[model samples]
Target: MTTPSAEPRPRFAADAMLGRLARWLRTLGFDTAYDPAVHDPELVALAAAEGRVLLTRDRHLVAHLRPERAGLITDDAPLDQLRQVVAACALAPPPALFSRCPVCNAQLRPATEDEAATLVPAASRALPGPVSRCPGCARVYWEGSHTRRMRQALSRALPGWIS
Candidate 1:
């Protein structure tokens, strides 16, 4: 008999205080929305409209919305928060989520330094060979200290991940 296929990764919308978490989710290639000013009710509606899971720290908001596609944000730190979601969702860690743009929630695209010369800071551009850009927000990103930190955290949180 054939084994069942793994479920698709779940999408998410994060509340105000969970901005960092939302960004982390995006960094992990999850379609995560981070609207700091969005109210609980609006978040609920948007999550429903988009068929995304609501990620929030507010217990009342979760109870009020009660969306089947919802998950609670337990930890305060961004990495910890991601770990919680990953564990709760029973997702494969590491490469399962990586190299996504957090700001606009877009996948990162490869571009040569020459190609991105006009779009990135001189300091940033000078540091690397090629860079990645967010098609949705036009933000640029590359492997750096932040990536190391996040990788370390992912390691700590998901030791079982085959990486």
Candidate 2:
């Protein structure tokens, strides 16, 4: 096994059951890996290989792994799960919204006007704001109602962390 880094930004791999938690983490700009097809052993191995802290609701799996590397989430609610994770890992919210693609877990990049014109929907294009695109999936993102809601949720979850 490889030694974990001391200065590593917290990375995570969530088990199949924690899909919502995984997406929320990605929304917070965390590098979270989630795939329903991954079984427990493979998921644990992947987390170990990638230097990630494994997040799961499976107590059995957690019992099988080193305590330092795995976190078993007890809460059923997504917000509670998020709170548990933040408290457990001592996480700080991302500095910017839409910094990562919630779907593919890829970092988002600024979309050029031309790119936005071609890629963004007509309704979104008409809105006055900057847009970003995911290089992995080419999905366009903007500060729309959904973004505002997510930001609000994060702010509430980690008060004074997100501006």
Top model number, lDDT: 2
Cα lDDT of candidate 2 equals 0.83
For candidate 2, write residues 1-163 as lDDT tens digits: 1224463458899999999999889888889999999889889889889878899998888877653488889999887898899888876566766688999999999999899888888877887678999999989898778887987987887788678
- Backbone clashes, each candidate: 0, 0
Instruction: Identify the leading candidate in terms of TM-score.
Output: 2
Candidate 1: residue 95 lDDT (0-100): 61
Q: Mind giving the per-residue lDDT tens digits that candidate 1 earns over 37-103?
A: 8888888899889877788888888787686577878788887887788777765554644567777
lDDT of each candidate versus the true structure? 0.73, 0.83
Cα displacement (Å) at residue 107, model 2: 1.0
